[model samples]
Target chain A: MTNSTSIPIKLQDRSATEEFVQKFDTFLFDCDGVLWLGSHLLPLVVETLEYLKSLGKQLLFVTNNSTKSRSQYVKKFAGFGIEVTEDQIFTSGYASALYVRDFLKLTPGQDRVWIFGENGIKEELNIMGFDTSGGNDPRLDEPFDVATSPFLKDGLDDQVKCVIAGLDTKINYHRLAITLQYLRKPEVHFVATNIDSTFPQKGLILPGAGSAINSLSYASDRTPEACGKPNLNMLNAIVKAKGLDRSKCCMVGDRLNTDIKFGETGGLGGTLLVLTGIETEERALDNTHGNPSPKYYTSKLGNLYEFTH
Target chain B: MTNSTSIPIKLQDRSATEEFVQKFDTFLFDCDGVLWLGSHLLPLVVETLEYLKSLGKQLLFVTNNSTKSRSQYVKKFAGFGIEVTEDQIFTSGYASALYVRDFLKLTPGQDRVWIFGENGIKEELNIMGFDTSGGNDPRLDEPFDVATSPFLKDGLDDQVKCVIAGLDTKINYHRLAITLQYLRKPEVHFVATNIDSTFPQKGLILPGAGSAINSLSYASDRTPEACGKPNLNMLNAIVKAKGLDRSKCCMVGDRLNTDIKFGETGGLGGTLLVLTGIETEERALDNTHGNPSPKYYTSKLGNLYEFTH
Candidate 1:
């Protein structure tokens, strides 16, 4: 996979920046490190996004975080003074919902989608017109006891056709026990919003979707189909839903393994790595992560504003 | 890894039984399924153990169940009308404590062992005289929020030399969060009692020690040294503690991957597979599980008593 282009071209040059910007009609962006880190907006992000908007570029936020719905993302974008519509943002939660509805195609009223996640997944699945159970249920909050757990005592729901796992901060043994009940069945399918092990927030590394997914998977001895970044399933869902030409899309993020690899593997027009978050310029240039290299990189997302001038 | 000896010899034959009984002086036995599954004792379990005891064979109960301590197991055995001492039982909890104290060899006082397990692990560590924290802590029951978690907010303890994981029914995001904090540090060693994904109890398959270990490993991006079953660490520990000759030791278990393989890999005198539990007689003869074949096979542990008559 090595080539002269494997060394990502720095988009600092005015002409090179212009060419890179002109090549993509739609920009798919990762949120955490690119646009903001936690609640704080990164430097010149609004200005750079505004510059892209002035040039008529379609802006779509794609994130592996399954904790927030599209509507919640719209609110988060608004909180940062960036104008974004709910339709333009795709979260792993939404992607998982799409995967369950479109890909798995469970029969309505017959096949139930069991969720081992939070309200974000429930909200997305609800928006998609799918009936789901075990999402942010207060009953799961009760301490787990093998003899008393209704989930364990009453047996599993036979109608569950698929089990979708996402980030669950309220994750407990009860939630995982119910999820394992479905996953252990040969007929039930398993899907993960993302297999990201951890995500950085507020200077603390927090357990991500994979923690929930991995626990259930380990317990059930089943591997789930991931519907997040670099999976191609999430990318296909976005492309088919938006009707965008793959040749005109670019992925921008600070993570090489997720955001950059997602674009590269999906055969998008370009992938730009930003060094404002998890990845560094040296690690990106090292070419040994086994993840696909980004086509171009800059010091930060704000550096792309230089292209407009 | 394949040979003619792969075909396990059935002990139903009188001469074969005699040879098997005469071959080993010390017998390492798995607790669950082999003796009593959950609370009830298996058929003729007492008679079989008595027969072995009458023959002057030293019997030791080695279990992957990390939720119970040696003393607890002694009570359990007593409840089942069996006579056993604390030293005769080697639970995964005790194995984990041994792993932390002897294997990792953490400096006393200066290096504390952090636990992500239940009372069993804590009790064993306390008996081993290692300073431990985070085992079955009632405070971890509080709802997880990034702003409120003391483990997350106060930062990680620098004195942690090893993080030992066992079966924790009270497993929550908070416990995992703190465990992740310690595991993320390069200096902290990771260890697991056993990686048994699920265990059968009350006709329900429940999540096992691997559920806790896998989640932490996934989040921390670290592999733990497992001290249960087929891992020679537990076997070596038992051998070292008992001062037993490997050629005089025989392992009798109802599982192939963990019990039989543990004996086989540890180069014991013989490994006997009992069909009253997880493994079927048909599967034992198939020789396709990628696990080493047991040296002998029988219908149940009770069948061994026939040799004494």
Candidate 2:
């Protein structure tokens, strides 16, 4: 409800940067614009991360992107010469899996999920020992008749207890039809990885997980419990996994709506906004977006390199 | 706002049926469930049509189905031994073309359309002398990367002035992306054939034209000007083309939301509800749907045969 665009404390002085770094024992970083954009790593991210590691701060790479698995993220990190373990990366896919297994308390063997995503979700749910169907299946690659297809008659497996929806390139009527079928059941759980309507790639914004999930929600007249940034579930999953005190943790990202709002609502120690992605400093100061204001602002992640020096 | 369940006048008596027949000179009929369901003709439909024609009533088949052209519907009518001309059939596809050509007044060769449907929409638009792209094009049948694809860079023709979306069996992310791209422009028009959330086939309900439109609308944050049943655009198109007096025409269908509401909002003489489709007799009488109550109710089209006899 508050619409005041209060200017955040700019991290300009070396002492100010050092003082800011001393506050948080855990650092949660959003991947895309903060660390890298498309295939290229941003400047100073490697050094800043290394500095945080030298300070013995726990580091976690959190991304709303549900396209890749934790190991894939680790590989991506390694590709950038940043040594990261699978345990340090938290993606929407991994968060969704954790939400289903731990928060929802659905037994892996007894419960099953119907996924509307690609390999990322499948791999994570597989790691969690959960049985899932309808993800990246070539059988569902082609369009199916909703009326006459034998699939509609009795093809849906009734054991599906939850529906995990994300960014699916192969999204079609058949996948949505089955997802709707499960969602219609009162007992079935509906979980969305994230609802970011569009994501930027190479300066062009394209439809994201929220767009697909929006379609399913509109058709089914049901809203999913999202397990991504800004929902607090993803942050809570990390907290529960690492046993970290929420008061000593901070979230750092470029987008205010997803990143800063996530930290604010998720009860993190503080939020830092970097102007390396979608939002401009002028727009961030406008406050009409209704996003939570970050505690600190920097031109980019590279500014934090001064603290390490 | 009116939720009172008012019992419709049941046309059981011969005099009542005769009075119902005398009330309207032109008869607008909804196809599926009223005359036929899928490939099978319903009971007494052929005889009822013959009886209505014998009474010198002008018969028009108005269907919300957007998958088939008027000629295709005519052929469907022929398949059932019921003779109908292309002029006699008013499909959502035909209605959409007319809306684009006459209502929206987008010029041919000057202003183009980006369609999110099948051959039905394409053919009708061609008939209306409008240039169109993206409908059933095998090139767009599969999902395309909206951000990285060269098409997104500048592949879209700037002359596209309108977006027409309907029931496309081969709908994918690419078509929707193109549609959204056009919709983002303030000058571009957005039109939907119908907003029927679901249609019944073989006793099972399947996602309809609204599902696709809903997705695009959600992504684009734009609501389309729907041109199908229940919106009254299709009915108005028919009335304008035929120059028929509104008081002399009546709409007949099984569904209350689409058919009966179309009549009520479209300024028809009356709406007659038949109990062979999506809405049950109990549901029609319940009035909780907030749909216009039909003036007359019958078990099926067969009930009108009593007056002819």
Candidate 3:
């Protein structure tokens, strides 16, 4: 649903919320801001999600955060008194793995993929039957001395023909140096999980995956094929895998540039914006820059709880 | 000198070389590809410098490599059997220091400058008499864990109003995280030594200072005021500091983008390109992309040795 109005209609009343909810059979929810901020769960997230489930709506948690695997996310949901299966979650890491396997056409067991990220990327890629290296390696954590680096001394690994970069909490110069060596080759395919610059965490903005991805891009002078929100590839993959009707899917996210754009680009039934994330309500309504505006908006995801009846 | 020709005039014969040498009273040299590759001097560099010195030409070694200080560069020169004083060298680190002191108007000793580079940047900033922090800090070398980071616990230091980023061989996420906190504040000034993507080292293209600088820039969503080559500020600083006539000085470098554009933008007597580094004879003469073309070209810097006689 493309709304030309500068201001998104707020789903304040029960009637409007109810009418909006009935329009979609499946809901794609962004996890970081809509469900939780940092570690603590947002207010009424559990109630709202439960209410949506009660309405027989399929809920899939779509997150750009590549730090955690599907199993880890399932555990996180369980910790928060919410039950979410691995099938109900889709991460950028998983998307990257899918892109690598299906698009790049690399034989899983034969080709080694070099990862410049955390365990999430490695775990997801391994699940896809690919041999992975360089993720969370203790050797990469060491201080980078050009002359002493074993990566330079040993030369580039001929086996590793693809590099997938995601958010790495333990990012260091040594790891980047090794990744650069792989990326320097023209034949090595470069992929990034997401290009989100910064994410909201405990009222502070921290460097996101884009920072790591951009560092390599700038050094290698090559742009990586990004497999994240606003790219449409991830949404297409989800729809294809789950066999969800695009006409009955509503995307609920907190970011206009990524989540909202992703929904609009993929031609979802509707897009809902929540104010609990990176975008401000004022900036969202401002029609100055031709930004993707959400069809409906609410203060929190919990606002839909009352309309569940 | 601006050359209208698509191809730069080659300094081949003795008459052309002699004519070129007679035009400039001073020579500004780029270190890496011109004088040396890595840890070793290029062919006939000793003889080249000696010949220029014999002609009573003022020689200033200007480099974008921010890994070493002026004194360190002097040692490198000495190791190569070339006698050069500290004032005769201008590093991007030193240029950043000067920019911080003069342009940023940061008070010496009173104001604190946060460094995101190697000892070269720290040493230069300290020489300018500014209180410096976070360069080669053992604390920042630790693996970055958001929950346990001391920076997150302590919060951003209010005194650090300026962040000068350069090349750091040991760049880590913790260091970048701290830098991002400072940069998040709009009041803080962001300065970069240079933004050269990669540099050739021992037949391998390695991540340069731009990689580290870009990581912070991408994370913070801010553009840093660069003080290195192609910016013209460094050249202006050099000209003013030395009280030399711009018309009498010629720039000699290997890269066309940074080194050649720098001289061209500064309106030097001439900008000479050497094929010992990044640029090639083919790309230099392409003239399709509106790139800053060199006034003259030679196979290597050592070719100038014959002209100096």
Candidate 4:
């Protein structure tokens, strides 16, 4: 898998699509723009997935959204009339928890992690048997007093060895203060779910997990070891868990930065960019300087049905 | 004055003290650490100010704390047995409001400015006759719903031509969301009170105004036009209002980054770095590549009294 500066092979015709599909046994799909947009599915996506499955290709759904647990994601897939096990889904939440448990090698019961995220990450961490605090804690939502607040005193928990940050709607000053305090200790680990600055919400790009985590990063002068798409941690976790051959896998998604770049950096067999999401075909063709270019490009993921038969 | 890479002149003996004090007529003093720490006044500061006053030297109090209004600062000065008028106190809150009203030239009654700070900024902007919203608003403190929130829709007001961000205890997602929304429009002005990442609180350095503003800056991909110490807007505001000669004014502060840098960048007569605050003498003397060096160094602001006779 040599890096190339040349334009991606456009999979428009049946012959090009057939050649591209035959190269990989497993397909990693990005959920949002590739699978569906909000509550609505894209054109011919159901047929495309069904056809691909009929061809005996393994399917996996990967998303940087750390807002939902794997169980919740499976339920969402069911709502779309698609049956996917929890194992088939890889979210930033699961990846972050796995990274803390396996990579950082923190003792699940003894080591506590302070979370700056929602229930998704909390649930994942809990399932992995890690003691966690500071996420949506009712105490954190309490009023913050600058002068008399005990938080201004010796408020840090010395036992907390890691801080996991993700998309948190309940973000407040106290949580950020504690996170900063923990990060001040040189030995404490800082893990971020993903670094996506903005995610689509109601047709507008709203601040995402990266934005939430970056607030603390800026204040604390510490950077988190991110474990999501565009980073190889999520893919590495999947590859390690499933014992799949990395050379036989392909990443297919709508965004170039997260999906295509994820494949490129993670050493996946190939990357296919579908122009149904955030980026345009013109941008895919343009020389993006240092940005990773995909191996194949198509108008939409639905176009894969051409070779599925 | 010519910029020199040499170490700052240490005013340890009588001659250096007299020579340095004779150089400037108007003295701008940073309140915290120089005059007081938290709530305790530093030794000999009262006598030093009295002696400087007896010598016909003009005095002014400058602080980056946007948590209190000018009247509040005056009250604090009075509590310390210091006689100072509201005009003698210049806070980041006042500087920010003045920047919006005078420098930006936004119509006070007609145009609206959204605030992301506390009562200090709100009161200052109100005093300057500008109608503003979103600072410690009760509505903002309400729980944020990511999925169904109307903030993702047309949440921006067209009349909101400027956004002033400072320290807000009630800082929430909604305020940041609206701030980002307004910043997306190129015509909307983004003003930050100060970029101080941390300030001393109870012997610990806690997150400051810069931390709050930087969070939004990172998310929105926009840089704010900061109007605090080191940026020169506050000093410039005072200079414009008082019609004082810049060569006759000197800035005395404990922190080199805020006070000394503020004086240097604002083109004041001199900068005096005191050892009573955030930085140590070793750090002040270190060749900090791009950091502005002070013209003179003293153990504390009280040491200025050596030249009173």
Candidate with top lDDT is 3
Q: Which stretches of candidate 2 lie over 4 Å from their true place?
A: A1-5, A9-19, A146-150, A153-155, A306-309, B1-5, B11-16, B146-150, B306-309
Which pairs in model 3 have colliding backbones?
A: B1-B269
Residue A72 in candidate 1, Cα distance off native in Å:
2.5
Q: Between prediction 1 and prediction 2, which has the larger TM-score? A: 1
Q: Candidate 3: global Cα-lDDT? A: 0.88
lDDT tens per residue, model 1, B1-309: 213266788988678887889888999999887987787678888998998899999999999988888888888888888989988988888888887877677766668888888778878887777788887777787866677877667767777788989888888888888788888889889889899888776666778889878989988889999989978889988998899999889899988889988988888888899987777888889876677788888988887776656
Tell me the lDDT of model 2 at B304.
90
After superposition, the stretches of candidate 3 with alpha carbons farther than 4 Å from their true spots are: A4-6, A306-309, B4-6, B306-309
Residue A61, candidate 1: C-alpha displacement in angstroms: 1.2
Better candidate number, 1 or 4, judged by TM-score:
1
Clashing pairs in 2: none
Give me the runs in candidate 1 sitting further than 4 Å from their true place. Answer: A1-5, A12-19, A306-309, B1-4, B11-19, B306-309
Could you give the candidate ranking by TM-score, starting with the highest?
A: 3, 1, 2, 4
After TM-score superposition, the amount by which residue B309's alpha carbon in candidate 3 deviates from its true location, in angstroms, is 7.5
True contacts kept of each: 0.68, 0.38, 0.75, 0.38
Residues B20-48, candidate 4, lDDT per residue (tens digit)?
88888999999887899878899889899
Cα error of candidate 3 at position A54, Å = 0.9
CAPRI-style grade of the A/B interface in model 2: medium
Assess candidate 1 and give its lDDT: 0.84
Q: TM-score winner among the candidates?
A: 3
The superposed Cα distance between candidate 1 and the true structure at residue A60, in angstroms, equals 0.7
